[model samples]
Target: MPKDKPLNAAARFQKTLDFSAADYYDQCRNRTYACCFSVENSPYIWENYANGSEKGKACIVFEFGKLRAMLNSALNPEGAILFYNGNSCRQIFEVNYGLVHYVPWGSHRTNEKHLSNPILYTYLKSDRFCEEHELRISLSAIGIGHFALKDGSLIEFPPTLQLGFDFRNAIASAAIREILLAPGADSSFLKTELSKLRIEPAPTSEKK
Candidate 1:
């Protein structure tokens, strides 16, 4: 929504929408936060995410079911709500996880269903990235304003929001299956740090 950049370029499809649909898309973008993972152990992901740095990259493999369960239990408690903007904004905290749907970038036609359901639009991506086999976990809290105010005017909040989870405990339990180091990563350093957390680095070929 901010700019037609690589990560959010799919948002450009908003141009195809009328005012009402575009307004809904903007609302969804403001309230949703998403995290992406690959179903495969990809060298491309390692290289790009690490910004071509060789020695500091590592990936932790999670058991999908366990990870999802932990996240749902921790983040989405029953009956959570926030009162804002003269309304009771019920917390629609969803732990939705699934494979991403990729379409050709040149295909710009708007789907009727997607116009009605703007949140689903978040799962669409350019087919150029299909090789990543991406799985996304999106959390949304609708009807709440993510902003700050100073002196009776709106102030800019940080670009990213921090959502906390008990990951250390989850890792100690069954949420994490293994940790894989990149080709040139400092294995010894990582192993030592993981040791403090009682996690041992495992071979990349190891299966959950």
Candidate 2:
């Protein structure tokens, strides 16, 4: 008989950021929308997450149109957190209170982790801001296969935009984040002139 495939074991436990929900609640600080379980009673959630029971449950990154839906499901209006690393969410895409896909400010991640859900990040300073921004943004890009190494992963092949541009040398993913960050960014493509690169889209509309 053929050997059985290895089971996809649950993910390992991890510690959450060093801040209590009360600290954020008192001043409405560092609470972004659409990330984890709850900054409130976070210590309790942290304990559970550290025990490996919360692995597959947490959000990983954006999933197209789900961001807005999750926010509306939040139990508390102030439960929103700045960021989330899909690694930390207790439920995959467990958004609440109209907060689906809408990432809050000052949230953090040193590398790309928003592939599975998009609402994972660490709050900066645990100090939340009142006013947010116009339109949401994505920190990473959707790739052909599994995520690439942090160093120079996205590349152009015969780079060309169907919109009539070339970006043979542009860091496509990071550049998108930049364009979102700064207003009036040169929203142009085709970094390597007209005839130097190639870019193509998927031939089918099937979901992976």
Candidate 3:
């Protein structure tokens, strides 16, 4: 999950849109899952994400195009199928990817145009985090199984769901470029673990 500053998606729309619109946006957002990455492998990222941990910290460098292709192929092959009222329906399962746009707080104002596609708000962020240089991959399945119907009754599913992908296939596809261990990470432990999996760890680089 990606955390944002206070003035995020919902806050940006609260003042401009009506209550219903805002509520709908929140519902849609709840069904969305996002993964964030940074273009730069920086000390700031290690300080915040690694938390000075001495173990279990590593930054994976991925070939973005191959990664995207692998995700699309593994997770949403032939689109996603849904059951509504006992009838099967097909919905395109799309993964949206783009750079995060940072702007001053309160600069984003919702308008009539946004009503048709409010999920665009997810990619916006407060300028305070500009140093992150974030690239985000998000999947929004607003109608997954939330409103499944069976024999004239609503079949409820969990509000949140987990999605998985083929990790071994991703690695085999040459999606991973390198795996950089964080400063002070437990190199011996990590190397041994990776070795057991037959993975060769990249050489440790001098800390910045």
What is the C-alpha lDDT profile of model 2 across 96-135, one tens digit per residue? 2322233333443223321122132222222232122113
lDDT of 3 by residue, 101-142 (tens): 887755555452334464567788888898898999987766
List, residue by residue over 147-202, the lDDT tens digit for candidate 1.
Answer: 43333443332345556666577766868877777667898887687688776544
lDDT-based ranking, best first?
A: 3, 1, 2
RMSD of each: 7.2, 21.7, 7.0
TM-score of decoy 2: 0.16
What is each predicted model's overall lDDT from 0 to 1? 0.65, 0.26, 0.65
- Under the 3 Å rule for N, CA and C atoms, how many clashes does model 2 have? 53
Candidate 1 runs further than 4 Å off:
1-19, 52-54, 79-92, 143-158, 195-208
- Higher-TM-score candidate of 1 and 3: 3
List where candidate 3 sits over 4 angstroms from the true fold: 1-19, 77-93, 112-116, 143-146, 149-161, 195-208
Compute the lDDT of residue 52 as modeled in candidate 1.
53
Residue 36's lDDT in candidate 2: 30
The estimated TM-scores of all candidates read 0.69, 0.16, 0.70
